[model samples]
Target chain A: MEDVKVFGLWSSPFTQRVIWALKLKGVSYEYYGEDLANKSNMLLKYNPIYKKVPVFVHNGKPLAESMVIVEYIEETWSQMPLLSQDAYERSNVRFWSKFIEDKSMQMMEFFVYDGERQERAIKETLETLRVIENQSGLNEKMFIGGNTIGLADIALGWVAHTLPVMEEIVGVKFITTDAFPNLHSWVKNFLEIPAVKNNLPPHELLVEYYREKRKVFLAMAFHHHHRH
Target chain B: MEDVKVFGLWSSPFTQRVIWALKLKGVSYEYYGEDLANKSNMLLKYNPIYKKVPVFVHNGKPLAESMVIVEYIEETWSQMPLLSQDAYERSNVRFWSKFIEDKSMQMMEFFVYDGERQERAIKETLETLRVIENQSGLNEKMFIGGNTIGLADIALGWVAHTLPVMEEIVGVKFITTDAFPNLHSWVKNFLEIPAVKNNLPPHELLVEYYREKRKVFLAMAFHHHHRH
Candidate 1:
């Protein structure tokens, strides 16, 4: 019996990335949902560095960082390959994975900020998306790595599900059929995958959660501005 | 004949990481020093997403992002193993590598800022180093992965060379013998490695370069402040 466990927050896109990867590989594991306000001691112990989820514990050895954990899963399980066989292709996938991971934090700024900052962040996010739409070759291919879903696809999988909730709350739709045809199609194809479609958090719940979260974030930003 | 070409700026630590890895593995390659102002068309073509240095091209296929390129080097050459044999250990090393890579840009802020911002960045950099010193288990182990130098070491190899130059320019030292004993010792061990020792950018040249670079960065920050 493989004693695999995942510690995660219910609404976090990072956590969802791990869960989707695990499901795609057909791995059965226990899920421990963590309360961000009062985090579990086990989660703390598992991931001391970030003290955030999702942390993957395999036979008591804990691994943090969702992408790193996903890579570990891919390496350990041979059932479903998450990376490409060709070295150059693998590097390409990894490059985009890193790109999206780095940008995701920056991209969230537009969702939580108001006024000029929000406008700047929105412009930057659109520019980043435009680059992806043009260069990722998602037009001809269903996924970042050819047709089959792979690491880069999984890394980017959240934009398909969570970005809609954020867009609804912010009153800005990023991936329209006209504006980002390739990205729009890619999102549709990504959501159609059984593993991804089945495992996503409820849309209504995500909208509610992000709505409150954005309030707190904007409040804090306002507070900081006043203090400064 | 294998065509392995690296397009890099001599002063970049990220580029040096790839250089050390390839040299350690005894791979012969051509080096193209890029003028950042007038970047080579090939460099621009290869890494269109980032349009940055340290682009490794092997047999016409380009790989960008230093860590991604290092992994590619490890996979392609299969010479001196940069990663561990165990799956779990590899993840741990990769976790630290990712952590350091993510924090590095923020860390550089200390060198380029003044007054309160510089102090804040310095404190954060120290806190990050403290975590590595206390928890990363460098005290007992020679490197991040047991005895042999691996990917994590290569990812962090910049501190041994570039960091000291930055420290000299900034008029502050981060890793002291008494403060970060293990890291200090590890720096000595890392420098003694022939592959690393041979490839390091000349110390005097680096110090001179960073001094001018710091002036430019500080001037840009002042310009932004004035504009605001």
Candidate 2:
């Protein structure tokens, strides 16, 4: 068997996505933690376009982008499928995944900045959650694509683990028992999965990491605002 | 056979992507041209979130987002396969497609505005082209995937057909034989396909449509800049 190598930053939720998918599929891989600020040549060569983390190297070839790698993992392993068998169902799953991937940043802007910008981001975040809640029937389905944790569930996985850390830091919570109840429960079902539960970065560690990162982010944001 | 319907604006290159894919795969579909300003209720219902086209309705169920719909078409039809058979190859195809889909709007910003903002957009757009030109293997391959026109090629289909019209309006050409010889040749290979060649809006019609659109966009840009 060829050695599978994953180049990622431990704290990146994006990197965590590939890890969860691989673990859920019961594949073995060696993880290499990269300092994103000082990227290794291997990481640079593997992912020159984005130079981002979660570059999956399998049997020498590398694939960049977390979700793209997740899809490759899904197709290659072909066990415990993340997407549905039916094409329409797969399209539906891909739609929600794409929605989450597209909106992930905008939905978390409140955690990154303060003031009116954060207020607008809060509204946008709620709308995103609302759309998902309406789409997912939490009463019937445990995960996004009925009973099992599928790709969309993985796509929204960070919302379960990271969103809370961000919410705690900012003192603003987007998901609650009253609003986004379906999505709220979906997060619970998502975390209970052994693969996900076991693979997550320690809660306190992520909080600490994001806390310091937030200060740097705020400084950068302030500088960017003033310059513009 | 159930009638396949596409709701889109004719001038929109996004709509043309679905059109090209269907035609390439030898699938029959009814085209419904919608006035984007006063969108049809069916269009709104089909694509509630984006409220944009090309919305693909196979029977009653609708799929929004041009590339998403293109993927759906490729999966369902499965004749003229738009992606490679190997998992890694498919991932590569999808990576580039996602890249194009994400950057499409930003790449076209220069065409929509003028002056300093447009200058910034122009720099961004060139960077995007440079990335693709380098990564795409355009020297060896006729299209993004291979010799055949696949999903990435379809994703970038607008660049061949629509970008020229935009260049004509702005008096700035992005892809040239001297600068992007590979992408330059790719545009030629892409347009040579009969499905793409015949499906594009007439040259004069597209130029006229975008000319009018550029005015509206500039006017809107002016208002937005002043309002801020």
Candidate 3:
């Protein structure tokens, strides 16, 4: 087998996605912890398009973008399949993955804004969550990709861990048992997976990191508003 | 062989993506043109989550999202392979496809905005184009997925056909011969493919439709500004 390497930031949910996928597949890879403030030359070279971490380099060839990398990993390593056997099932997984990827940033926007902007983000976030809660068939299945911990579940893994940290720091709760029971149960089931449980970053460290990041984000938002 | 059906809106680039992919693979399916004003029950039933068009149903299992459908088609019908054989190559294709999918709407913001917002959109559009032009490796390869028309090419197919129509309607051109030579060549090469050439919507009709759509978009923007 060729050598495998992962360039990742410690606190990134995207990085954790890749990490969990690798662990689930039982693929041994050399992990490089990147300081996001000063990205490594390898990270830049590997992912020149985004200049972001969570790049998986296998046998010298590099693959970037977390979901894409996860898919590639699934395809390359057949053991412990991340997607379904049926093409349509796989498409359903991909659909939810794309949906979450598009909305996840917007979901996070509430943490970095105040007043009307924050309210707008919160509403949008709830709207997105409602769609997932109602339409994602979470009540029927333990995971988004069926009974197994599959691709869509991995894509949504951030909500289980990272979102809670964000909620703690922001002092706002979006996912409550009464409001989104299906999604709440999903969070529990997803985190219970041994692969996900072992691979997550420590909670307190992530909260501290995001707390500082949120301060910077709010400051920038204020600066933009003042200028306007 | 199971029954195949496609629920799509004629004018949507996303619908065309699935159409082109199916055509390229020589998959026979019934195309149901959707009325956006009053969408069909099948469209709603098949794509309940988004209630969007370009829902492909095969053997009674429905799938939503254009790129996801394209991947399903590729996986189901192995002939006329839409992704590369190598895992790394496949990841590269997916990376570009995801990048284009994410940025295409942001790039379109220039079409409906005026004044400072329009200026910001134009700047963003140029920046996105520059990134694609410089780093997408289109100069050496015929398509972003490599020598063959693959998922990324189909994902970006709209830019070749729809973007020109949008530019004409908006009275602005972003991709010129000198500005994006590789991409320009790519457009020509992409259009020359029989599957794509034969499947595209009529150029004049697209321009007319987009012009009307832009009017509606601008009206909404005006309303938003006034309300805010």
Candidate 4:
């Protein structure tokens, strides 16, 4: 039996990325939910540097970083490949994955502010989605990389679920078919995957959780603004 | 015959990563030096999204982002492997590589600013170095993740070369032996590698180039400040 364990947070998109990857690969592992307010000692011990969730341990060795863990899962289990066999295709997937992950935090800016700042964030978010719609080859494929779900798809999975919750809280919509036809179709296809569809956290609970979290984030941002 | 070509800037650390990785693998390719002010049409066609070098082309397929290109080089050619074969060790290398690369841009802030902002950047740079010195296992090995040169080392290779040039211009030094003994030693070991040693841009020329570039960056920052 493989001794695999994952320390994660329930509502974290980063944690969901790991869970969805493992489910896609059909790897069974113990899951330990972490409280960000009071992180577990084991979680701290496993990932002292980041002290964050989705710390994966396999056969006694521990790994941090969600994408790093996902890539390791792909490397260790050859059951369902998250990347491509062709080196060129794999690099293409990786390039898009990096691009998406790098922008993930910034994408949340739309939900974190109001007024002109929020409008700027929304415009930037739309611009990013526009790039994905046109440039990521989504026009040709069902998913980010190809017809089959892959690493880039998992990297971008947050857009299908968490992004909607954020949009709901902010009373704004981003991925309409008129504006982002390819991404509109891509989101629907991504959510249709059994691994991704079945494994997501409850939508209502996510909305409630983020609603409260957004209050705190906005308050913090306001405080920061006043200080500056 | 391999059709390999690198579109790069001679003074760019990002471009140097691709060059070093190729040299480490003993791969030969034609090099095209890009003029940032007058970027080539081929370069723009190759990487339309970022439109930046080093854009690597192998057998006519083009790739952008320096680290992404370096990874492709590692994946394609098996000679003088830049990443560990073991998945666990490879994950470790990748984690540190991501950490360092994520901070690389911020690390240059000290060079771009003066007075308080520069001091803050310097302090943050030291904190980052301190984390690597104590936590990244440089105390146990000659390079990051192992005793041999690998991806993380290449990711961090900028610090060994370009950082010194920036420091010379700004009159601020980081990674002194007294402050970062492990990194100081690692720098020596990294540069001692014939691939890294021989392929570096001429130091005096790099110094001259960046000296002029810094003046422009400072002027731009000052202009932006006055506008605000």
Please give the DockQ score of every candidate, comma-separated: 0.91, 0.82, 0.84, 0.90
Please tell me what DockQ candidate 1 reaches: 0.91
- lDDT by residue (B22-84, candidate 1, tens digit) is 999999999999999899999999998889999999999888999999999998888799888
Work out how many backbone clashes candidate 1 has. 0
Off by over 4 Å in 2: A136-140
On lDDT, the stronger of 1 and 4 is 4
* DockQ leaderboard ranking: 1, 4, 3, 2
Regions of candidate 1 where Cα sits further than 4 Å from its true position? none
List the per-model TM-score of the A chain: 0.98, 0.97, 0.98, 0.98
The per-prediction CA RMSD against the true structure, in angstroms, equals 0.9, 1.1, 1.6, 0.9
Model 2 lDDT per residue over A163-207, tens place: 999998888887788977788788888999999999999999999
The C-alpha interface RMSD of every prediction is: 0.7, 0.7, 1.2, 0.6
TM-score of chain B of each: 0.98, 0.97, 0.98, 0.98
Native contacts present in candidate 3, fraction: 1.00
Candidate 4 local Cα displacement, residue A151, angstroms: 0.5
Chain B TM-score of candidate 4 stands at 0.98
- Candidate 4 segments exceeding 4 Å error: none
lDDT of prediction 3 = 0.91
lDDT of 2: 0.91
Measured by DockQ, the strongest candidate is: 1
How far residue A220's Cα lies from its native spot in candidate 3, in Å, is: 1.6
Better of 2 and 3 by TM-score: 2
- For candidate 2, please provide the TM-score of chain A on its own: 0.97
